[model samples]
Target chain A: MAQLVLSNVYKRYDDGPKGLFRKRKVHDYAVNNLSFTCEDGEFIGILGPSGCGKSTTLRMIAGLEEITEGDMYIGDIRINELPPKDRNIGLAFEDYALYPPLSVYENLAFNMRAKKIPEDKIQEAVSYVAPLLKVDDLLDMKPPALSGGQKQRVNIARAIVRRPGLLLLDEPLSHLDGKMRQTLRQEIKRMHHEIKCTTIIVTHDQMEAMSLADRIVIMKDGVLQQMGTPLEVYDDPANEFVAGFIGEPPMNLLPATIVGAGDGFEFAFEGSPLRVAVPEKYNPVVENNMQVTLGVRPVDVLIQPGTEGSGAVPVAVYENLGDERRISVRIGDTLLNTTTAEDVSYHHGQIVRLSFHAERTHLFDPKTGNRIRSNVEWR
Target chain B: MAKIELDGVTKRYGKNTALDNVSLTVEDNEFLVLFGPAGAGKTTLLKTIAGVEFPQKGLVKIGGEIVNHVEPMHRNVSMVFENYALYPHMSVYDNIASPMRSKLYKKDEAYIRETVERVTKMMKIDHLWERKPSQLSNGQRQRVAIGRCLVREPNVFLMDEPLAHLDAKLRHFMRSELKEMQSSFNTTTIYVTHDYMEAMSLADRIAVLNHGKIEQLGTSQEMYYTPCNEFVATLFGEPEINLFPAEVVAENGRLYLSALGQEGLPLEEDVCQALVHREDRSYDVGIRGNDVRFSFEHRPGWMAGTVYANEPIGNKVIMTVDVEGTHIRLVAPNDTRAGLDQPVYLSLNMKNAILFDSVDKSYVIRSDAQRFTQTAAAAGR
Candidate 1:
């Protein structure tokens, strides 16, 4: 296990129609100036939306795509120019490309045999990894005979059997069903624990990235927005995109007119005609009647309207999610959402008061969406 | 609004039964969801309701009247698939207006455009009306599909994962929008999805299907709190529910199951009954990670387990605790001080436990003797 690094990486493609054999260079900058490090035994996730150059970065690391510019290193090695086989990485992708003709056991052993490993070592390795990954019984089954989840497990086992210093999984859970995905997620987490390999996975799914990685690398349009542990990302999101992206039933962003200054102030929202108290930290930045974006998560936004606090907009629509009912309120033009205690039934268009926590509220610069300085205390 | 029904519906492709004797009712204006994993016949059920697929041995009814052998158009149902199936060449306005094109529709142009404009504004896509599908984003294209559906003023709306193609941000935005719109339209809707989040957050009631059969149906809370069996116990939530094998121990005057993993945790009446058997056998105990709590102290009702891993997700931490021979997840709050591989006590949440029989794997939670006796007396009287 070692620290993997990428420095100022870049990619460009040629696009043109000037001559029969001529082309014009188009600078796409797919991984422009991207730099990050995954430490020894660290499990980091590369997360972003579609077309965000995450896959391109992973491919570049795998030696499948040439690094257009800059240096790449695994541990102390300047391994950008090294072949994939020499780099020593266990890799898995969304699609499992297994040999249909080979049985699971044979497939696990084939990679080692190609390297001319002794039959005893191959069997030992297979036996060691098979039961840990819950694929011990599936060893004799061919690819066609196994279910999708089984095949994925075998694919992962194939990638990790050699005990590579690093592991790269690209959306490995994307192809399975919801239930199967959850089950495999537990198995993968368990596998990562027992064998502490430095892992880096690329995914567009925030839930996967948040749940699996020790720290997450968030990318957008080839630019790094933020990199931190999942707690750091979700609690103190760098901006609107990160805040909106991380949570289910995402944080409710209310466009507000910052009313007063001081530790205890009020924010009057436009459209929704609602107001909430702001903690002292936003005092200097908030100006009376100036537009600012107020961020409150469904969890932090509380009901119990009569609890001697600023109230929320009345409820208009409620979604009963069993665990929680996400209710929407119409306050002027804005819609505010808060998760009520499960089994609290409310009718549509019912008016209810909501109050945002002074400590839990977040403020962002309306135009840029960057997290503004605030006194809202958090973990 | 319409009441849609399926009776003895069975469809087969070669030897596989996509839908097997599935019968259900969708009351007028109800937001009903047919939710399941892929190939569990969710789409097939939706198609059958829309007259898209002919069921070999059943009748589909609209407004309590059988619509067997009826053409799709005559059935007056609108369908939306994952692709949206919008016409690429047609602008959003024309696409919305296309449903009205069967007749000359020249005189009805004003009415058509009005209704299109109404639904367009309602779906928040009025500005993109003149743009072709190629120019619009996936979310915008979906709105266009919904606009076309609304223009028809059909009594039934069948949506098959209409929001599957959008990004996370847009999906959340649209999830709420679809919920609000579906309620406002009062259209009898049959929504199909493989996403539990969507099913939980969007539906008035969810019908969980497995192997082409309705395993359970209820309000989202009922499904979450009282899953009919083991399959549902594990299927309905994120990070998944934890199923741990437990042994039954009958003590003096009460039923006490062995929970050595988290010692002294009170085994609720239901959990004790789930473990009850004439043969004194072991059984499975199903509890959601969110409901299970872990403590450092060896409280009387807690079991000791090793923390296998910690999965962080901002608000909560999912800790997989290994107890005995099985590993179960317990959603720890973010601020919990437990470290990885630390020996900890997992206190079973008695309030949320849904117990099942080990052999049959069915719901068999035992109620309190008092409640049972009361029900028995009431039945006798």
Candidate 2:
């Protein structure tokens, strides 16, 4: 097992004005100045939108893409120029990428034999992996005979058979259905726990990143938007994008106008006014009458009712979520989603007060997604 | 103003029966969802309801009137597919206005523009009116498709997993939006999807289908807490309802389960009497992980288990606990540092337990079990 690091990683395609297509730089940077480290035996996720260069970063680590200018290291070895085979990295792409002609057993043993590992060790490796991946009975079968999950499991087992220093997975669960994806997700996590190999997976899914990774690196437009543990990214996002990207109904990103913001934070939208206790940290940088994006997670947004003094917005829209009911209400341009963990029903368009926990609040710059400088981060 | 009714609906193509003997009634203004796994007749049923496909042996009625022979266009039902199916060359305005134009609305161009404006504002796509389909995001395109469907204020709507193509985050947002849109119109919509979350979050009631048959149809709460059978019990919940090898026992003039994990549970005599009187001893006791409490130390009523794995889900965690050689999930509150093989006790909250008949495998709620199984056998002890 090994820890990997990339500093100031850059990937520029040969298109447009410069390389691939024309004189116009289609993308100034596929990946730019990206830096993060995956500790030994830790699983880190690369999360971003499709064009945000998550794949490029993974490809760079796999030596499939060349880094324009960066320092890359795996454990103590700097493998900037090493061939992929010499890097001793195991990779599993979204397509499974299994050799169709070779049987499951032969495919797994191919890499081991190529590396000149002993035949006894090869046999021992297959025996050990087949049972864990639940593919022991399909050793002699070809990829054509295996189901999607089985194929992916076999592919995963094949990737880990060599016992590479790191495991790289690229959207391995994208092709599977919901239930199968979830089962396989658990299987992969269990596999990681059992093998204890430092792993890096790239995906555009926030749920996948939150569920599987010890830490998540969120990228956008080739820039590192945020990098932190999932909880850190969820609770205290570094930017508006990160805050909006993490949770469901997404952190309600509403444009807020700073009213009287000296000691207490005074907020008013449309016909409603709300007073928020300013975290002493943000109070310093948050000027009065400054424009900021006020964000709150749906789970934290409380439903205040029947209070005449600015407690609730008068609108209830019904959402039947299995055992619970979620009510969506509009406060000016922002929508608040309140969930009741019960089977009760609520009339739509009924006005209800919404009060947010000030401590769980987030403020971001309107122009840049960067979190508003505040006293909270220093704490 | 339409209540859809199906009687013995069966559609056969060659050797396959897409829909079989399906009889159902969708009340007027009711939001009915058709849910099933792939090839389980969810789409086929929707198509049949839309009058695009003919049923071989059943009558389909809309608004208290049978419309099995109605043409696709005359049924007043608009179908939206998983793909937005918008014209690429036309702007969103033209795409939305196409349905109205096809229906031969002879209102002046001003009325046409006014109608387009109303739907555009409602869908929040007013700013993207000039953009063509190729220039829009998947979500934007979907809004246009819905806008097109809503142009004439159609009485009944059919959406076939319209949000399936988007990413997870976008899909969540769109589900809420779609539900809001459906209720706002009050058009008595029939939505179809393979996603449990979508079905739960959006539908007024869900029709669970399997192999051309309706497993059950009820409100989301009914479907989750009170599933009628093994398939329904296992299909709806997440971390899945933990099924354990439990047997019924009677002691101290009370009903209890003689299980190994916990010393014993004060069995709900209703569920047990139902199971045991049915002469079913080898039964799988169904319990939700959320209802199961985990403790660091073993208690008398708590079952002993080893922590198998913990799956952190941001605010919460799903702990897979192994009890007596079987892996059962335990939904634990987040901010926990419980690790592998950590010894713990899983307490079964008998109040929420659902007992299944090991033989024939049907859920036997209190009264029904007693009625059917009184003479079958003695309550196992």
Candidate 3:
């Protein structure tokens, strides 16, 4: 097992020419000054949107891409100057590039054979890893004859067959269907537990990162935003982008102006009749007449059938989504979504009372988009 | 808006059957979603409605008129392809207005500008109007394609996974936006996607297809609560539905379902009554992850199991438990934690359990019917 550490790593790329007359002069930072550490045998997920430099960071760690600055260490050894072959890292990418001509057993033993490992040892390694990935039956079959899930399993088996100190997987489940993806995700988790190898997976899917990783590193536009466990990131996001990007149906971000009301602060939406009292804990971070954005997840918003209360908004759309009921209310130009139980019933155009859980509500600085975290601990 | 209908539609390409004996109806101004996995004939059905593909057998009707032999241009339907087929040379403005400039729907420049402006604004692509397709992102180009389709006052709209290529956050935003757009336009729509969530959230009715056959057609709730078969039951829901082969044993005037060497999972009285007439002993128990409950302490009627793995997925934790030899997944609160190989007790929410015939994969007992009748009998009592 290897504990990986990256200290202020940076990857820069030079832009190509835009026109015949001019050459681009500036260098683009695909990965800015980013740093994180993965403990030994720990599964870490680097998650972000496309072009967010997650893949770049993973490539740098794998020695596939050169880092322009800073040092990378694997358990006290500097590996920035080392080649990929010397890093002892097993790699599995989105494409399961298995050799079609070779059988599954041959594919698993190919890497060992190149390193001049004895015949019996290669055979023993393939046999041991095949059953672990549930590809024992597929040993004689080639990649072309196997299903997508089976092929991916074989690919992963080949990666672990070498027993490398570190394993790097990039969007390993992106190509599979929903059901197949879930099944493979469990298989990967099981394999990790059995092998106890340090692993780093880069993916854009929040659910995948949340479910698989021991810790998650969320990046955006080449900059590191937050690093925490799935629950920590989901429950208390560092910024508006992390808050909005982490959850399904997303967090509702409504631009509101803070105003003094009854010895406390209330956030009043612009050009709408919706207003919510700011939680008392946020009073220290917020000021009267200050511009702030109020953030609340869809699950945190409570909805009633009628507009009988002080904070009631008209429902624009109500959908029964089998597992849950989603209600959308238009406050100002922004559509705020609230998710309720599947059994909850509401009609379109019906007025509904809306209330945000004070403890769950988030206040953000409109200028920097950072969360206003006071001393109060979130439940 | 027009009501669309397909009667006994079957399309074949050489030896391959793309669509087999499919029939459906879309009411006027209603949004119908054709949902299935890849190669399930969702796109073919959408094309048949758009008059882009001709069916070998069956009638296609638009607005109560038979349009089986109608040309694509005369069908009065606009389609948005999975790949946004925007003209690279044309600006976003021109691309959106191209449908209006067609000979079939020729309009004055002022009217075209007004329509384009309205649609572009609605799609939030007005700022990118002057830029060509090459300059826009995938999401922006998709909006332009949708805007192009929306600019026309068509009889029906056919969208083939328009949001499939978008990122997760954008797709969620676009799903609700598309629903709102459908309502405001009041246009009949035939949307196709493999995403069950999209089908559930966007459709007034969903037609689930598999191997070119309609597996089930109903509201999202109906299909979810009363799935016709194991295939339909497993099609929706995350973690998929847990399906394990079991044997239905009747003893002592009570019913029990046993599987994987574990026995005596007692069924409710209502469920027993429903399964009494079934002669088949072999069955498949279908339970959603959320419907299965797990605890550290042993409870009566609960089966002992070992935790295979516990995955925390933000809001919920999905625990894969080994009950005997069968793997059963159960959902719990995110705060719930369990160690690997830890002994735990598992119980099913009897009200939510479903049963399927093992031989033919058909539903033997549907929980929705049991719940409905139970409520009715309670009201009567």
lDDT of every model, 2 decimals: 0.78, 0.79, 0.85
Second chain TM-score, each model: 0.86, 0.88, 0.87
Question: What is the iRMSD of the candidate numbered 1?
Answer: 2.6
Question: What's the TM-score of each model vs. the native?
Answer: 0.85, 0.90, 0.90
By lDDT, highest first, what's the ranking? Answer: 3, 2, 1
Best by DockQ: 3
True-vs-predicted CA distance for residue A327, candidate 3, Å: 1.6
Candidate 2: which stretches are off by over 4 Å?
A: A15-26, A270-281, A340-345, A376-379, B83-98, B103-147, B151-155, B269-277, B366-381
Cα lDDT of candidate 3 equals: 0.85
lDDT of 2 by residue, A105-198 (tens): 9988988899799999999999988877778899999999989999999888998988889999999999987767877887888788888999
Give the alpha carbon lDDT tens digit for every residue of B1-381 in model 2.
Answer: 588899999999889999999998887778888987888999999999899899999999988778888887778888888887899999998998887677454456778899999989988789998999999876678789988888877758898998888766678767766766665556778999988878877776789999999999877666776677878887776767777667766667666666655545776656555555555555567888778888988677577888777766655677888788888887776666676778988777778777776776677653233322332123110
Worst 10 residues of 2 chain A by lDDT: A15-24
10 residues in a row with least lDDT, candidate 3 chain B: B372-381
lDDT of 1 by residue, B293-331 (tens): 788777765677777767666566768877785777877
Q: What is the lDDT of residue A83 in candidate 2?
A: 92
Mark the regions of model 1 whose C-alpha exceeds 4 Å error after superposition: A13-27, A99-106, A109-112, A117-128, A136-144, A259-266, A306-312, A331-334, A340-343, A375-379, B85-98, B104-144, B244-252, B256-284, B337-340, B365-381
